[model samples]
Target: MAQQERAIRTRRTILEAAGAVFDEYGYASTTISMVLERADVTKGALYFHFSSKESLAQAVLDEQVPFGAVPEQPCKLQEIIDMTFVVAQRLLTDSLLRGSVRLTVDQATPPGVDHSGPFRQWAERLIALMEQARSQGELLPTVQPRDTVELLVGGFAGIQLMSRALTDRADLAHRVSVLWSHILPSLAVPGLLLGLDSKADRGLRVLSAVPVS
Candidate 1:
């Protein structure tokens, strides 16, 4: 058990190192040597966990959908808003998340480097939130959860991409707040919509509430 736990720790260290390198250089420019140097582990140690850079890239991509610090809300739509803001906040500070977002959208990956899992996970969460909002009478009758979720996912991708390019994502939370404020009125019932927390710091407050380990 001790050995297994140590292995898990070692693997996490390596993944974080590799993610940092990926974020710095992107996939095509990233090399195993860079990750090895950053990880401070022998090549054999890296190979025991990840055989190649592509495998590491996949692992990093899989790490993107971490839903940290989102306490359940009376309004399900609030939960979704919280999720977006938290992710934006994370994108700014978390190397793994920043790496994963870039890797998932980057088209120059080696052939068959699939990032469908993260995208599907995002869709599932948004769809579930939309469904919950419907149950709580937060959504308009004309708002189809699946369709709205799909549009939201697409719009979020574009907004983050533009933000990353323009501001290195410094304005991500603000952009996301603007996005929710503009779209919520159309999709949500007026009563619930007015009560939603669409501010940029919505997720930051949730994050700040958790004690740092």
Candidate 2:
């Protein structure tokens, strides 16, 4: 148990060091030696945990991606939206994660790496929630769940990029709130707006290792 605990601590140290180095130097310019130095670990120790730099980068992504705290509940539209914003805020506020986002966006189409797993998982979950909401009549009759999911995810990603570029000084929370408020009225079923208006009654909930920005 003690050995396992030590291993866990070492792995976490490596990841945190990698994130810091990547954030400071950008991914393309960062090297394993730099990570080793930052982590204060021997080459063998780093290799024991991560086979390669690519694997280390993947580990960083796995560590940073935020997951919902509400679990897979009844899939109410408002619930999903609330969860998304919570996760978004968590991601946006995290400097490390914002750096990760920058790396992902910059290296999304790297030569042999499939970087779409996280994005696809995010879209899939949102699509599932939207589909459930559509079935429950929470969305407009004309709203297509798949298309709306695409739009929402795409728009959210775009906004996040903009927010990062602007260094989060533009009141991202307020802007996101306003954007959702305007968009929800169009996407939601006629009487569902009231429920959405009450979304603030529930606080932001998220699951991730990084601190909220």
Runs off by more than 4 Å, candidate 2: 71-75, 92-96, 197-213
- Candidate topping lDDT: 1
Clashing pairs in 1: none
Q: lDDT of all the models against the reference?
A: 0.85, 0.68
Candidate 1: tens digits of C-alpha lDDT, residues 134-176: 9878888999999888888888889999998999999989999
Identify the runs in model 1 with alpha carbons over 4 angstroms from their true place: 211-213
lDDT of 2 by residue, 1-213 (tens): 999999999998888788777766777888999999988999998999999877877777666446444544453776677666665665644545655555666564355444555577677877877888888878888888777777877776677678756865244555567668778888887687776742332334433433643
Clashing pairs in 2: 93-213
What is the Å distance of residue 75 in model 1 from its true position? 1.1
Leading candidate by TM-score: 1
What is candidate 1's TM-score against the reference? 0.94
Worst 10 residues of 2 by lDDT: 198-207
Candidate RMSDs in order: 1.5, 3.8
